[model samples]
Target: MANWVRISSRSIGNHIRKRMNQGFIGSAVDINKSSGSSSALHGGRTVCDRNRRYLNSLPWNRATLFWFQRFKSTVAEKQQDSFLSSDTDDDQLSLDFPGGKVSYTSDMNFISESSQTRVPCYRVLDDDGELIKDTDFQQVSKEAAVKMYSKMVNLQIMDTIFYEAQRQGRISFYLTSAGEEAINIASAAALTEQDIILPQYREPGVLLWRGFTLQEFADQCFGNKADYGKGRQMPIHYGSKKHNFFTISSPIATQLPQAAGIAYSLKMDNKKACVVSYIGDGGTSEGDFHAGLNFAAVMEAPVIFFCRNNGWAISTNVWEQFRSDGIVVKGRAYGIRSIRVDGNDALAVYTAVSAAREMAVNEQRPILIEALTYRVGHHSTSDDSTKYRQSDEIVYWKNARNPVNRFRNWVQSNGWWSDQQETQLRSSVRKQVIISLIGLDIHNLHFFSDT
Candidate 1:
C-alpha cells in the first residue's frame, strides 16, 4: 500500500510538472530551503503566505509539494494528514476544482435555494439628488457636469421626438432612453474617444457624446443616401467607424463575444484603450453572454461588459429572467471583477465607469457593471410595456427616480443652472431636432427630383 501510494503520488506530480512546463501554471514553484518557506511565482506576484505555509508543512518531496501547490485552498490547512489516512473525516476534506474550492462531506447536503444573497448596489446620490454622507466618488468639474446634464437632456428629447416621428409614420421604429438617460450619458462621459464601443440599440447618447451630429442621427434613422450605412441597416441600428462604434445588430448578445475579440485585438497591439459592451438584462440569458465573459476572462481582455438591468426585456420582466442575484454575480462565476451601481444616479454611474475603465486598461482584465434602473418607456415602438408591467411602477420610476430630474437637482444645488437656462436648452434642442429632420427631407427630395 505504501509503494502504491508513492507511485500514484509520483504519477500525479509528473502530470503537474508537464502542465507547468506547458505554461498552464505560468511559472515554477520556488522553494526557500534556508528559510523553510515555499512560494509560487505567478505573473510576478508572490503566492499567498497561507499557501506557502501549507506547502511547507507537507513532506519535502517534488511530487507532494507540486500536488499541494496545484490544489491549494483555504480549507486545505485543516487536512495535514496523508491522503490515504483512514481516520480522516469526509467533512474535513476539500476538493479544489478549476472553478473554485469546495468542501467534501459524507452527509446528504444540497446547496440551499436561499443561498443567493443580493449584491449591494453602489450609489453616491439619493433619490432627491443629495450626496449620501461618507460616500466617495470621482468629482466632476462644473463645465463637464453641465455638459453631461445637457447631453442627457438632449438624449431624452431626441428619444421623445424620434418616437413621435415613428408614431407619425415618418420613421419605422424607435427606442427611448427615458428613465435611463443618466446611464446612457454618464457612462459615455466616463470613457475616452479612443475607447471602442459595442452598443445595444439604446445607447445613442454615446454617439451624441462622440460628436455624432443631430443631422447624422436623422440621416441614419431616415436611411437616406447621406446616411453612413447607405440605407442598408434599420433605423436605430446606428454605427460610425469614425466614432469607433460598432453597428447595432438586431440579434441579442452578439456584440458581447465580438467585444471580447476586439478587446483582445487592442491588447495585442498594445493600445492604451479598452472596449465597452452594453447589454440589456434580457441579453444576459443568451449563450453568447456566457461565451463572451468566459473568453474575455481567460484571455485577460480589457473589456467592460455593461449590463443595463432595466427590469424588463421587452414584455418579459426581470423576474422571468435567471434566478441568480442578477447579472453581476455572473461575472464572479466567470472570474471577472464586477460591481452593481445605481443607474439612475449619474454621479454614481460616472464614477463607477471611470474606475472600471482605469482597472480594465491598467490591469488588462474584464469588468462587469450591472446598472440597476427601470425602463420608463415601452420596449420599443414594436411592444407595449404597459401590457405586462404596472402603470404605477412606470410612473414611480419616471417621476420619483427620474434620472434627468435627479441630475438637474444636483446641478441646481451647485447653482450652475437655472429654470430659464433649462427652458432655453429644451427649446434649442427641440428646434434642432425638427430642423435636422426637415433638412433630411429636403435633401432626399432634391436627390429624387434630379434622378
Candidate 2:
C-alpha cells in the first residue's frame, strides 16, 4: 500500500510517454485512485502500470534512485530471510528499534558449521582373506561350527525350493537370501530361543533356523488354509509370535525404531530378551535409521541393529548411496557399539553376532553389526538384476564365496560332516518340500478371504 517515488530525467520520461501514448499518465493516476477499492481495482487491473508512471514523473538522478532501490530490496530480503530461516540464533536481527530504521549488518560470517566426520569400520576380515583380530572375536566351538554348516545347507535348499514354487506359479512372489545364507543362518543360530528376531525382507533363513516347519512356510507362501497370517501379507513378510520373530514391514527401516521400543520394554521388565533387527544398506538413508539409533542409545535399549551391507540395494551400490563410510561407522554417531564382519564367512558371522548378543544382554546396551554380504538373486522375483548389474559380478560372487560350499568345505576338512550324511539330509529335505507343495492350494482364497 506504501508508495515509492524515485528521481528520473524529464527527457527519459517524455520518451517513455511517447512509446506508451498521450493518455498513459492520466490512466495510471486513475488506476492508482481506484486501487483503494476492491471493485475498482479488479475492473482497472493497472496498479503496476500506475506505479511505473509515478516513478517516471520524478527527476532522473542515477545515484539517489540506485541507493533508494537497493534500500527497499534490502528490507524485502531481510523480511524474507526472517520468514524462511529458523530463527534459532540470538544475534540474527532485532527489529525492536526506535522510528523503525532498518538496522541490519551481514552476520552470515558468524554462523558455525558442524565439524563432525564419519568414523571408520572395525572389521574382523579385511577385503582380502587376512584376519584382523580383536578382543571382540570369540572363538566358535567345533559343535557350533557343525551346527552352522548344517543350517546353511538346509537354508540353501529351502531357498531353492521356494524359488521353484514361485516359478511353478504356486506363489505370487518369492525372495531368496541365496548368497547371504551365512549371515541369516549363523546369526540366528547364535541367539537364544527367547531372544526376539526382527527381520527385513530377505532373511527367511533365520525363520527356518528358528524351527519354522516346511508346511508353515508353504502355507504362508501359498496363502493356503493353514497360513497363520491369514494370507493378509505378501509371501516373504513372515511372522511367528510363538518363536518371537517379529513381522516384516515393506517400508524399509521402520522396524528399527519398533525394535528399539521392544528392547526398552525388555530393559524395563529386567528380562533377558534382546531384539535383533535386520535391515539393508539402503535403509540407512532413511530418517528412521537415525531416529531409532538415537532413541536406542539414549534409552540403553537392548537392541542389536544388524545392517546387511550387501554391496547393492537393488542395484544402487554402496559407493553411489553413501560417501561417509560403510554402514558400520554409522553406529559411532549415536554412541552405539558396532562391528563389521565378513558376511560370507559363517564362522565370522557367528563369532561377531555372539559377542554382539553378549554385549546387548549383559552390558544392557544397543549394538550394531554391519554384515558385508551380496544378494545372489535379483532383488526379488519381480526384479531383473541383469538390467542394472553386470553379469561378471554375479558369476564372480557365485564361484568364489558361495556360503554353502565355504562352510561345507570347512566342515568336511574337519570330518564334522560326511558326503553320505549331506546327501541324505538334502534328499530328505527335498522330499519334504515336494510333498508339502502337493497339498499347497495356491489358488484357494479361503485363507485371505473374510479373515
**In candidate 1, residue 326 scores what lDDT?**
85
> Per-residue lDDT for 366-450 in model 2, tens only?
8999988888888888888989889999888887867777777766767777989888887666666656755534454222212
Model 1: residues >4 Å from true position, as ranges?
Answer: 1-108, 114-116, 440-451
For every model shown, the clashing-pair count is 0, 5
All models: lDDT? 0.82, 0.73
In model 2, the runs with Cα more than 4 Å from the true position are: 1-137, 439-451
What would the TM-score be for candidate 1 when compared with the true structure?
0.76
Model 2: residue 223 alpha-carbon error in angstroms = 0.9
Q: Count clashing pairs, candidate 2.
A: 5
For candidate 2, the 10 contiguous residues with the lowest summed lDDT are 67-76
Candidate 2: pairs in clash: 7-59, 8-58, 8-59, 8-60, 9-60
